[model samples]
Target: MRIPSYEDMLAAHERIKPHIRRTPVRTSDYLNDLAGCDLYFKCENFQEPGAFKVRGAANAVFGLDDEQARKGVATHSSGNHASCLSFAAMRRGIPCNVVMPRTAPQAKKDTVARYGGRITECDPSTSSREAAFAKVQAETGGDFVHPYNDPRVIAGQGTCSREFMEQTDGLDMVVAPIGGGGMISGTCLTLSTLAPETKVIAAEPEQADDAYRSFKAGHIIADDAPKTIADGLLVPLKELTWHFVSNHVSEIYTASEQEIIDAMKLSWKHLRIVIEPSCAVPLAVILKNPDAFAGKRVGVVITGGNVDLDKLPWMQT
Candidate 1:
């Protein structure tokens, strides 16, 4: 696969600008004191589709030609990407077919449907999701937009960090939750080019720490259906994402399930925003290792806010 260039990222920003919201960068004095650092939160949760995935989804959807757009796009996502892609397709007035894990949050499924995306549910495993997606693609002939692995998607995700840089000055580091590494890869791509002095850190749930293991192992290490409260982060790193992780990431950190839950609740309390568990991993890691970021100006990417109100993680037994 051809790696997307800095130029591609700039092009993607231009292509997706009109379609996506330039979400606000928010800061909380409470969070800053807790983490022992000045923290700037890029609020992608305020995105139209309620996630940063819309940046990539919109880029991929709008980048397509007339013929490709007619067939539409398809992908497999645990949650956010599916809804975001559906929202992008809806904006383009095209069809979007998504294969989501049967265990995906009801809120995400509802959003996907609300945006006119056709959903095909599969078992909560990478193999099962791929198998289900293959059938959907075969039937519809829609262009396949890999959630994190596609170059177009990564380039699109890069736009987030670009915007973050424009919003904040001299960020010592930027941290983002890593799943298949789409957001992190984008962060790496943007920082490596635009802000080379800034460190790029990836945060993951200890329960689903494939990227962490992969970073330590110096290669790709995938997990199969790893159970984590951060459901959006259960996916493993693909080759495209691994390239960015191995070469550009400053570090990989993991947070326990309880830590992730606490961080999620804390952000909601202080930031007055409902961020999903996946988005809390970065703050969880920061709270876990305060010394690493104590004096730094850190940018934390809040990846999404799509959660089922009836089954909040903290309220679960």
Candidate 2:
């Protein structure tokens, strides 16, 4: 697969602007005090589709010509990507076929279906998900929009950071939760060109820290169904995403499951905004390592808000 460049990101930004929201940037004084750093959150969760994935999905779906659009788009995602792609497809009046793990959050599955996407269930592992997606793709003949790996998707994701940079004067670091690396790759694609001095950092769950391990090993280290509260982040890095992660990402940090949950609660309590556990990983890691971010202006990507309302992780105990 080809790697997305800055130009592609610019084109993606323009293409997706009509379909996606220019999500707001929010700040929390409490969060800043707790982390000892200035925090500006790019509230992607406020998106109409409740996730940043919509930007990429809209970009990919809208970029397709009449021939490609006729058949529609297909992808495999843990949750947000599936729903967002479905929303994008719905906007363009096309079909969207999604292969998702049966174990994904019920809320996410419902969201996908609400947008008229056909769902194919699969086992939770990456291997099984891919196998199932392959069958679906072959049958549907839809344009494959790999959740994170495709160049179009990465370029689409890059728009988030471009918006972030414009909203904030500048930041010392831009931290986003890493799953398959689409959002982070997008961040890298934009910042590496747009704001070369701004560091792009990745936050991951310690339980599903394959990306971190891969970073240390200097290669892709995919996990097989690693469990974590950050369910949206269970997927591993692919070639296209690894390209940006290896080159442009400055650091990768991790937080334990409890830390993720605690941070989720903290954000809800202080920021007064709903956030998914996956999105909370950035704050979790920042709080866990305050000295690293002390006195710096940090831009945090609030990735999604599609949480299972009844099964809030913090409410379990």
Candidate 3:
């Protein structure tokens, strides 16, 4: 669990330039007026493979040599990371083995399959997924690309901040959702080094608040069952991420399920983007607490767009 440095992130941008998309930062006058702030959305949902996970996955896979790439790669992901890794593996002309929960969305699974990667379903528990992934690594001799805990992965994630900063001006705060903490950890590191005055805030779901709890407790907290519609945020925080977050982040806030659903619906109806629950978490925070960010320039990292189209979480039946 090593945190990536700003220099490492800059290098990662160079390494992954040809592979990952430098997605646009979009602004909405409607959202800005409602929140009382000038808001810029880093639309990673429009990113290649439809998520920011591609930045890390592509960097990790491409960083490997010909022989290492030939050995293939393995990881456990319930959603976006799997698709990104599959796409990365395809780029290298090697096989990608992804271990996912049996209950993962059909859309995500189909996307991974379309990218020419092999999928193995396992129980959703951390231990089970790890055991399954280890078996695949042993059997196929593939490199293990962790979803959010690796330094190279963190470095790749930091590039999002680089792109966001370049596309917008005068951001006072950048709010990003936290899961295993890869995105925020990398984002905070970049802001701390490049824009020290801009505070980084983490948006967590009330149902799965490991990062928030850990932030309040002043140490790494674990052993809590995650129960949230933001499935991507269910993973426990890693040591590297916890350290970076505690030192660099200004605060962490939690949003309820209904709040997330409202935000998701609003984004689709008003913003006209199909944002998943995890992607809606940051917007939920702003919607829930308007006083804090009112009249300030803020950046929201809209994480990904992968979702179950047949059964959307917020659409009333």
Q: Count the backbone clashes (under 3 Å) in each candidate.
A: 0, 0, 1
Q: lDDT, candidate 3, residue 176? A: 94
By TM-score, rank the candidates, best first.
Answer: 1, 2, 3
Residue 231 in model 1: lDDT: 92
Alpha-carbon lDDT, every model: 0.95, 0.94, 0.88
lDDT of 1 at 167: 96
> How do all models score by TM-score?
0.99, 0.99, 0.97
Superior by lDDT: candidate 1 or candidate 3: 1
* Consecutive 10-residue window with the lowest summed lDDT within model 2: 1-10
lDDT of 2 by residue, 151-233 (tens): 99989999999989999988899999999999999999999988999999999999999999999999999998999989989
As for candidate 2, its clashing pairs are none
RMSD to the true structure for each prediction, in A, is 0.6, 0.7, 1.3
Q: What lDDT score goes with residue 201 in model 2?
A: 94
Question: Model 2 misses residue 142 by how many Å?
Answer: 0.5
- Ranking according to lDDT, highest score first: 1, 2, 3
Q: What is the lDDT of residue 190 in candidate 1?
A: 86
